[model samples]
Every structure is written in structure tokens, then in C-alpha cells.
Target: MSAWLRRGTAATYAATLGVLLLGAPAAAAAPSAPAPTGAAAARKAAAPPASVDARLFLYNEHGQAAVAPGDTVTFVMSTAGYPENVPQHKTVVLELPEGVTFRSATNQHASGPCVPDAAGRKVTCTTQDPVDQLPATNGAWWVTTDFSDELPLGEYVTAKATLTTEIPDPEQDNNVSSWDVFVATTGDMSVAISAPPGPWKVGDKFDATFKVHNFGPYRAPFSLSSGINPVSGLRYSGWPEGCGFDPGEMQCTFGVLEAGKTFEFTMRFEVTEYDADGISLTPTIYPGNQDTNAANDKASYRAKIIKPSASPSPSPTGGQAGGEPTLPITGAPAVPLAAAGLSLLAAGAGALLLARRRRTS
Candidate 1:
């Protein structure tokens, strides 16, 4: 009777422990959260749309952000940001502004040339082969556009470029790029150097005058640089406040010169004893803007160095009035000539004295 009671009590305790262990987990477990809705749901869904990427950009061949009217400018459509994920073919659609016309598009990596539509307003660059690698995959195209002859100066022109690939882009913001260029005007810029008068000897200091003139229908705001090439024996001093000097070059800047306007400054330079025959100053002007006449953009001024003449020997003044004629003594010392003349006189007197003694005897 005792064994049966002990076994029954033990079995009841084990059953209660098992029930507590199973019930505790369910009571401590956290509740389930609600699903995302509306914009949040949309954003989550769009987060991992695609693995590939496409980006577009437009820039000139020179990498400058401006363009000139009546000029055929070469532009680059760069899709270098496209990824090398799946072997996907890429395409670029270039939309030009109204006054700009597409001339041609070429890609060194493409199997064929980029083609333009009938109106020449749009150009498409696509490679038939899949672009899965860099360089070998033609990642860029060179496009040419001819601006209308009448594009107004200082106006802003915008060109847009769109890049697409076989794979979808997760981010649409980088798929298109636009470039804004200012319609630059033409300015004829020329430089003139007025060096101080010749007879410029060593150790002489003088002013070298420089004049930069813009003979234009428009002002020159960009690409304007003027400078003087330094001569070996020339020393620069009293430099113009606007000019800068490196070791062997002088750089000058004149900001925003208008048509028929000129900027003048003088620099003082001294000649050193170093053997420099003549000084030639070639001041070059590169307006960087469209120059109508380039012939006069560079001017050269050459100044000759005159050497001091050797003075002629002073010939004895032609027989000064009532004065003895004096000959220019040449060779050795006057003492030797005087001694020879005395010896000759002594011999003649001795010969006369001996003859007189013989007559007396």
C-alpha cells in the first residue's frame, strides 16, 4: 500500500512540471507585428527592383561647360557608370536643343556608328553586342552638333541625355542627365608690347609696356590669358599688381574686357651683364573665346643692343701754332733713342778733334 502511494505521488509531480514547462513559453512569447501598408509598402517593394545601374552625362570634348554659336562642337555621352552585371546591351538617346543639330556620333568600341533620326534632333548610340565589361564595352559615344548661325550670345542652351540598358534600373534619378552651356560670343583679342627705346645696355632699367586689346562685337569673359616670355638676361621689377610671375614666365589677367576695350600695364625690367645681344618681347593673347582675327593676337617687338664704339687713338694735334712738330714715339723706351743719338755725336766730335791735333802737330 505504501509503494503504490509513493509511485502515484511521483507521477503527479512529473506531470505538473511538464505542464508548467510547456505553458511558460507560450505566455512569454511576443505578439506578431502588423504588415506595412501604403507608401511604406511601395518603397519596400521597390527597394530591390534590379541589380544593374545606368547613368548618363553630357560634356564637350574639351570638358568645358560652355558652347559657342555657329560652331560645330563635339560632345561626349558617357555611360561609364553602367554596371558590369549581366551581359546587357546599352543604349543612349541624346536630345538636342532646338537651335542645335546633330551632325554625327561615333564610338570606337561599337560595331557600328551611332545613327541620327530624320530630323537630326535625336541621336541613338547602341551596341549590338552585350556590354558586360569595361573599355571593351563601348561605354561612351562622341557626338557632334552644329549650332545655328544665329544663336543669340550669352543665351543658355540645354542638352539632355538618357541612358538605358537591358536590365531595369533600381534608381531612376541617374538615368537622365542634362547639360547647360552658355552661348559664348566671339572676341578678337590681340597683344602689343612697347619696349623702351633701344640702346638698352646691360645694367639699364626700363619699362616694358603691354597693351591687350579686344576688338570685338562681344566681350571676352573666358579663356583670356596674356603673358610675356621671360628673357634669360632680363630681370623683372615693379611688376603690375594684376600680373603674376613664375620662375621664367609672366602671366597677366584682365577680367571681362569689352569690345574695343584695352587693358594696359607697364613692367620694369633691368638688363643683366649676361651676354644677350638683343631683347625680343613676344606677348601672346589667347582670348579662348571665338576670335575673328587670329593674325594679330601675337605681337613681337625686337630691340637692338648698341655697343659702345672704340675711341680712336689721339693723333698729336696737327703742329699747334708756333709749337715744335712732335712725332708719336713708337717702340721701346725714349731712353734708348737718346743714348744712341749721344753716341753718334761723341764719335763725330772725336773724329774732328783727332784731325785738329794732327794739323797742330
Candidate 2:
């Protein structure tokens, strides 16, 4: 009986250990190693390669921001693109104001000669090529217009330009440019001449100061010429900054004078002869481009230069009725004195000749 009990307890302990082992969870597996990368897997996304752009600007030979009537403005049109075979509409449209007209236009890629034609104030520049090659893409067109005769102070003539391309433009800001050129003339430039102080002496140099005033409305460059009267006996000796003596007139140029502005210039004149009673300087101003009034364009001024008074000669008798007691001429005859002087001059000449001949021999 004791041996049977011991065997049954050992069998129960073995069964419980087997049940515990079966109920426990399984251990986790090892982490996986990554695969090697290739060239195809390393590539990144990129932007589109093909694009075109257009820009417009105004230019001139002298690079001035303002323009007057009959002035030319160069409209520079530039277009460039990468992978350039893109079918695009490259154009520049000029929206001008009233009183402005298109003069001419040229295109390098034009199929035929560019004879610029315009409809009123709208000017158009567009390439006709279906697929425009970017190599011959840049070009310019010249347009001219007449500014108003009179413009208000600080006002400018304006024109709008729109540059475009059919393809996507990387820069959309520069596609639109505008021109604001000032109309350079607004008023009449009136000038006048003033003669120097009068009663000048003959054979003396003098100066004539001129006061030029802008009487009309706008600012303008002026060319002034003073007509020198030949009878005035006043010869042009020198002139101030903008003055020059051209043929019969003393000419000078004043760049730009604004309204209510005054410019002073001095021209020197010398009295060449006596009897210079009514010397005059007639000045005429030719304002730039246009002039409003013809009547007031010129004015006259006069000056005087006279000969000095003559003094009375003293009497040979010293103002006495009876001349001082004088001894009769007791000297040799004038003919004999003259003969003696001639004989002495001949002897000196002979001596000089003898000395030269001896030196030569």
C-alpha cells in the first residue's frame, strides 16, 4: 500500500508542470535588415523644365525720362525661354493716351518687312510664328508721338504696355511695364536784353547784362541770339556760359527754364570807333520746338558811347599881345643842315659796309 501512494503523487506533480509549460506565451522574433538602395530609388521630384518670359521697357539714345513733341521712344521687347520650342503668343500691347499716335514698328522675326500700322492710339506687337524659336526672339520697335502744346506743371504723358507669353512665365511681375514720360513743354520762354550803363567811353570794353524770363506756361529749352547792330560800334569781345558769337549774332543756349524762372547772361562789347551814339542789342529767343507768340519773341535795347571833349590849344605867344623879345635865327640854313646830316649818315653807312666787307674777306 505505501509504494502505491508514492507513485500516484509523483504522477500528479508531473502533469501540473506539463500544463504550466503549455500555457506560457511564445518569445518575439528578431528584427529584419533593410535592402540596398539603387539609383532609380534615390531620384527626387523636379519642376517643369519648359518656360517662357517677356519684358517691356522704354529707352532712348540719351536716356531721358521726359519727352517732348517729335521725340522718339524705343520700346525694348525681350523674350527668352528654356527648351524653346514652345508654341507661345509673344506680344507687347501699347495702350496710349489721346493725342498720341504710333509712328513705326519693326520685328526681326517678321515674315515680311514691318510697315507699322496702327488703329488710333492702340499699337500692337506680336510674333506671327506658330512655334517661335527663342534664338531670334529679342527685338525693339520705335514709336513717336506729339505731346500737347501746353502741359500742366509736373504732369506726364503716360502709356501702358502688356507683355505676355502662352506658356507659364516664371516671373509674372515684369510682364507688364508702363511709361510715364513728362511732356517737356508747358509755357512760353520769354527773354529780354538790357544794355549796360550809358555814356561809355570810346575804345573801352563794356558788358551788357540780359535778363531772360519765362512768361508763358510750360518749361522749355531756349536758344537766344542777340543781333549785333554794326552801327553800334560795339564789337563782341566775350560772352557768358551759353553765349557764342556766330556770324552776325551772339548766340547762347539755355537748357531748360521753368515758368516764372529768371536767367541772367552777360555779353561783353568793345567800342571799336567813335560816334557810337545809339548802340543797340536786339535779342530774339527761339524756344525749343514751338513758340506761342511771335510778336513778343524779340526785343531791342540801346546804349551810348561817345568821344571825349577836345581842349583848346595854348597860343604860340603864351597869350601875350607882344611876343617875348626873341633873337633872330643866327644858325646855318636848313638846307645846309640837312646836307650835313645826309653827309654824316652816308659816312656811317660806308663805315658799316667797310666793317662787313672786312669781316667777310
Candidate 3:
């Protein structure tokens, strides 16, 4: 083709692209989000040039390249996102749902810090140390995450991964990857809670902290129940769901607890009376899809309430007011026998005369 004809075709193609990507989507979703502008239009038109691309792929453990519930996933990522002469950096961030767990980096492609958020739902793995940037030919780096056994089968949980760069990726769609995880069953679960150790006071609120431990090879749903001891008078003041209080009992049901993992919670209870110093209730796991051990599954949680004491009164010789006083006995000479006898006789006659006077009066 002639040089003039080729140049005219190129001009037409660029105009069409500018209208397609930079103009159309922005016109629809952008107006509802941000006000329309010519500068914004120009900026959007400039970012993706049809060159940059990053590929993030997910694979199951069995090498089938598919994800199944209760199985670990191998993530392979590489970069064609930058030019050969220039080094491309990727700080990958992934937010996993509740059922999926982040494993370790067996052969980490790039070296950086892997940190999880407080909820453990999101993790950021970056290459910050001696080795950084994606090597040539999409030098694939691999990381892993797993779905727990307790995860509900036939449910989909979204997994989002992002790659960060100084310049916008031309193929930004590949910079982020989205996939759904399908959960499957593994085995039975065993859950146990340590009884609260306490000699709590009566009529006062106290936390009945329980240490719930999962003792199983596979992750499983954690649900527990116990009838309120009628004699213990243990009542809930502040309760959370997964926990229920009926007229005679209270029960707790947790979504899932990972294998060899422990969870803790403080259930508020007020001591009504000291009738049962050692409060005990039979705790049992709410029967689920898989429950193996019934013996250890049903355990007792025992706590002691402080016994009441009665106030004591002061002793007679305790020096308290209104108490009987001690008698003093000083020495005195004994009276003569005749004088003693005459005195006794006079005293009797005087007593009789006084009695007669009282009767006459």
C-alpha cells in the first residue's frame, strides 16, 4: 500500500478506538459517578495502549487446573505488563472469603512481605527484598490458599487478586483476577470448650469465658448447646447470635472452626444465689453433617459461686456497750457469829414490818 493510504487508515483506527474504550463506558457509568469532562475523556483515552498484560491463574492441588472445595489452590502469576528494558513491579493483594484460608509460599516467584488484615480476609504479598520484579517471559510466581472442610458445598466465594504498578497497565483486566471457590467435605469434626474457672460473686455480672478448641484433622462447623442448670441459676445478660437463650437453656452455633484452631468468647452471666457453689452444666456440640466422638463431645462446664456469710455479734467481754459488766469482790472481815445471827433476825423482822406497812397502805 502507498504511504499516504496507510497513514490515513491508521488515523481512522485511532479515532475509532478513542471513541470505543475511552468514550463509551465512561459516558454511561462515569456520568452517574463523576461529572462529565473533556480532560477526563482525554486521560482515559491515553492509559491502555494495547501492549501491557499481566496474567494471574489459579489451579487445584491435583494438577487439574480447577479449584475444588477443601483443596488448596496454586496461584501462578507473571508479567508481560512492562517493556523488556524496564523492570515491572507487582505488589499482589488478595482478599479471601471466610471459608478459604491462605497457605504458604512454597516457591514464591517474587520475594516480599505477606501480611493479613485483622479479619484475616485479605492478604498482601509483595516483592520488596533482594529479588524483585517479574523476570523475563512472564517468570511465573506461585502462591497458595485453601478451602476448609467445613465450607458449604455448592457455594461460591469470590477471590480477588490485584497487581500494583507505577504506570497503568494497558490490559488492566489481567492485572486483577477473580475466581469462585467451590467447597467440598473432608471428614468429621470434634469441638470442645474449656469450662470457665471462677468463684463468681452473687448478684454481680461476670464473664464466662470459654476456650473453644477444634480437635480434628479437618475443619468443621462449630455448634454447641447446653441446658441452663435449673439449680445453678446461670442467666445470660449480653448474648451474641450463634448463641440462643430459651426459657430453660442456651445454645451456641458457630459457622466453622479450622482444624487445630481455638476461638474464645466471654458470655455474661449474673449470679442469682449461692445455692450451687459449684455451677455445672452439661455441654454438647449441636449435631452436624459430621460428628464422630460423642463421649468427649459431651463435657461438663463447672464454676463456683462465692458463698454468703452472716454478720457476727459482739461477745459479752468484748467491751461493747450494753454488755454485762464484770463483778468486783474485795476482801472484808467476817462478822461475829452472834452479831451475824442478830443481824439476820433483825433483817427478817424489818422485812416483815415493811410487808405489813405495804399491805395496810
What is the alpha-carbon RMSD of candidate 3 to the true structure? 18.1
Candidate 1, RMSD to the unseen true structure: 17.8
Question: Candidate 3 on 1-361: residue-level lDDT in tens?
Answer: 6999999999999888887868766587654656546744553445444444555554343431224456777555444444432333457787787777777665644445566777666777765532322332233456677777776653446777777764456666777776654453434444444545776777866565556566656565656776555444666655566687776577786666677777666667677877654576666764333446556566666677777788798754443467766565345544666688899999999999999999999
Ranking under lDDT, best-scoring first?
1, 2, 3
Per-model CA lDDT versus the true structure: 0.70, 0.62, 0.60
**Model 3 clashing residue pairs (backbone):** 69-183, 112-126
Q: Which residue pairs clash within candidate 1?
A: none
lDDT of 1 by residue, 56-101 (tens): 7778776543567778878787665434424556788889888899
Give the CA lDDT, 0 to 100, for residue 210 in model 3. 58
TM-score rank order: 1, 2, 3
Better of 1 and 3 by lDDT: 1
Candidate 3, after superposition: displacement of residue 307 in Å?
Answer: 4.6
lDDT, residue 163, model 1: 81
Q: Please give the range of 10 consecutive residues that has the lowest summed lDDT in model 2.
A: 39-48
